[model samples]
Target: MLLENMKMAFHAIRVNKMRSFLTMLGIIIGIGSVISIVSIGDTMRSLFSSLYKDVGLSQAYISIGYWIEDVRDSDYFTMDELDRLKEIFGDRIAYIDSAPSISGEVKAGGNKLKFNLSGVDYNYQNVQPVNMIYGRYLTEEDVKARKQVAVMEAGAAKKIYGTEQAVGRTFRTEVYGSMTEFTVVGVYKKEVNAFQKLLMGSSDDTGAAFVPWTLLTWPNDLIYSCRLFADPGMSREDMNQLFQEIMFYIAKSKGRNSQDFRLTTAMDEMVQVDSVMGGLSAAVGGIAAISLLVGGIGIMNIMLVSVTERTREIGIRKALGATTRDVLIQFLTESAILSACGGTIGIILGIGVVFVGGNALGLQVVVKPAVVLLAVTFSAMVGIFFGIYPASKAAKADPIEALRYE
Candidate 1:
């Protein structure tokens, strides 16, 4: 009986193909929107994990005081705020390795390359995990003694000696108003940020040259970032508070509000970023749900029209000793068929959207299995909820009335 109803349902839907397609359109759009939103969310999660690892998300770094969110905020800190920080915070805080950067040409045996030259303090070794491919990183002795020494990334090594053995090679870098030659003490692998398929050369560690921070400071500007590394077993919040205190004093000394100098731990910032993205994705999902609601309503309306058009047929079946249950099943089956077909198509379309988004946009559109299941289930619910009224109307129709009306 159920199988026969399904066959009849399909027959009815086929008879009005245009109407059926029109009804399914809302469902298609609904599913499509959901798929796109979920795909973007998955991609963002992937980007976050990958970028954080590459860019040193575990510990934050800055050119002035590291709390800066953008370039404009960084500029404000460099005027006079960073200097006052040292005077207030004193030794309870780790030393600030305000290694300013310089852009210049560095020359080796026969290779000349333009690169970003940075000066780092001894504590930099502890602050940042610079993966040395060969040799050793710059040390306190190098900075304090003003030793003619430098560190190179993989690109720099290749430019100079074409090999990691370039550790002992000397390169003359154009320094602050002078030409200086520093022997390469270390060579490190280049760092890359996430969004590998989107942004180019986004990592800070890529193709960099390093000098001692003691030998590098801005002539008259303040600082850019101030990084704070917690001592072992120290809470990140405590360190953050400490950093904020320093920023607070700097701001106060400068006669500005604490907000003038942003204070945030890297972890805090990263979590907030992820949270914001998550919220946006949820908003997209909510919008998609509205489409789904409209689609469900469409299903109800179409199913009711189908029942009305087949009123005479329903009455004949009932007259031929067909029970009300049989009539009910027939109409319900038609409704279910509409939804099942729409749902299957929606699933296919959703998967297609994710595939395109992931491959074309170079994002990790990780489709959660649960989400797919939920979407499919939601479609079925739409059918059931909307189908009931129409199916009941068909079952309750008077046999004589239904046959005579049409």
Candidate 2:
């Protein structure tokens, strides 16, 4: 009997195909919008993870004072402290490096360019491992001997030499208003994607050079930042303990509170970023739900109209012994089937859009199976909730009056 009722209900919808399709339009758009936003959000999270994975995952920074504070000269960390930290951490420490940079002009091959000149120890690459497309990275011997050798970023090499094959080429580094010569030992591969360029705030057309840390003059030289690398298997708690030990020693010696110094770990920052992205995704999805509500109202309105049109049919079915429960079930089934069709289509369209758009943007869209299930289930529930009044009204119809109506 239920199957027969379903056939009749489908027959009714088929008789008014255009109206049924129009009724489902709202639901399709609503579900599609929601799924697309969610998919994009998921992809963004993955992209962020990849961007920081190698460079930041096992990295952290230890610094004294906040940006707003007037830093005293005593705030500077000495080489002795850096060496002591290495001794204390021993094998647990992957690498410790510092980048002390200054803006300087470079002269090479009759081309003069202004570039960022950074002095770094050999371990700097352990934190930011460069893909050496040409020649080799800064070696321990170079840093130890204070060799006047430089490694160039791909963009920097291109600007000075008009090509990435700038290895073995010599460039003059300007220091203290005087020129000191250094040979380019390597060039790193450059990032060309627009998103990476914007996010990293680097112009591929610009140039930069790295030299040995010992070659940089003191008093006038200041370390811009320091990075510490931990072993890959190190846990957050272990990293925290290590940081704590260092901070406690620094604070005690300086007669300051530990909080006075700011230490940040990449793992902590990554977790924070994930939280923020999750909230953003949820908020956007919630806003998109307003359309679902509108779609539900549309379903209810159409179902009410359907009930009115089928009044005479309802009267005939009742005369032939159809019960109130039977009539209610038929209408409810019709509403559910209609909503399910729209939801299924919407899911397909949403995923299709995500894949196409994500591919174009170089993002890997990760579709959550649970989210898809929830959306489909929610659409069916909307049908049931909104179809209740119409189904009840149809069940309560007076056979006598309905049959006598025009």
Candidate 3:
């Protein structure tokens, strides 16, 4: 019976193909926009989530005196104070590391490469671990001895040595206009992800090099930012309180206000991501839904017009033993098929857009089964809701009056 009704619906649509296509346009655009946004957003979220998982989420980033000018050397966390923090927190604190960001050009052989530089302490690797393809990471002895050793990312290593395994090679860079030589002790596989690309602010060609944070002789230049990762067993509340206390201690030690510093944790990032995605989905989805509503209204108007045009046919069918329920179901079926077809096309367009957009934005693309199902179901519901009144009007037509008209 459903198949028979769908055949009649197809016949009706075929009779006015252009009108039907025009009517479906709204549904297509509405569903397409929403699905594309959702797919792309989900892909981006998944990518970042993976990155944070690999980097671990038990970490906190502390930035001190960022906007404060004339900040004294006492305002920064000294090596002694860092040691005191470890002693105070004991095993509860997994690692604390400081990194100062800078940029310099390094020369190897005849090749010179300009790269982003991170002056990191030995413990920095504990929080931001990378896959080392060659040699080894910096050691406590290296930092304590103020060794002029550096680790190069694969891209940088390739640029300098034409290979990723360039251990025991020396690179030269000038610090404060004074030439300093660094022996490359390690080469690491570069992170080739959207997050890393964005963080580096360069294409795949650019590379990052890490040297001992102690290379920066001035205390004021050493601890611009620090990362502290707590033990996994620590609760969120405890970690927050502990970090607050540490910041307070820094403030007290420097004779500055505690508010001058800021600490950002993984939990904070998680909440912010959720809030932003939620709000974005709501805003974009809400606007797209207006198109669906307009489409539904157009369907209702067209269905009513169809009822008027086929009034005589409806009456003849009623007189020939067709029930009102039969007439209603046929009309409802037509509306549903029309909407379902639009939704199917919209899904295809949306997925295609996601693929293209993902490639352009350098993010992965994904099509969620649940979201696709929801879109189809929602389209059918829209049809049914709008088709009800017109179908009812058709079913209640008087056989005598409808037959007498024209």
Estimated TM-score for each candidate: 0.72, 0.90, 0.87
Error of 1 at 51 (Å): 2.0
Off by over 4 Å in 2: 1-6, 67-71, 102-107, 110-119, 173-180, 190-194, 215-225
lDDT of 2 by residue, 47-148 (tens): 777777855687778787676276765566766667777887797778776646777677887998878877878877766777889998899999888898
**C-alpha lDDT of residue 207 in model 3:** 61
Write out the backbone clash pairs for model 2: 156-207
Q: What tens digits encode model 3's per-residue C-alpha lDDT throughout 58-88? A: 8888777577877776666677777788888
lDDT of 1 by residue, 267-348 (tens): 6777788888888888889888899889989999988887888899888988998899988888777777787788778877
- Worst 10-residue stretch by lDDT in candidate 3? 216-225
Ranking by TM-score: 2, 3, 1
lDDT of 2 at 34: 84
Native-vs-model 3 lDDT?
0.80
Winner by TM-score between candidate 2 and candidate 1: 2
Residue 334 accuracy (lDDT) in model 2:
86
Model 1, residue 307: distance off in Å is 2.2
TM-score of model 3 vs. true structure: 0.87
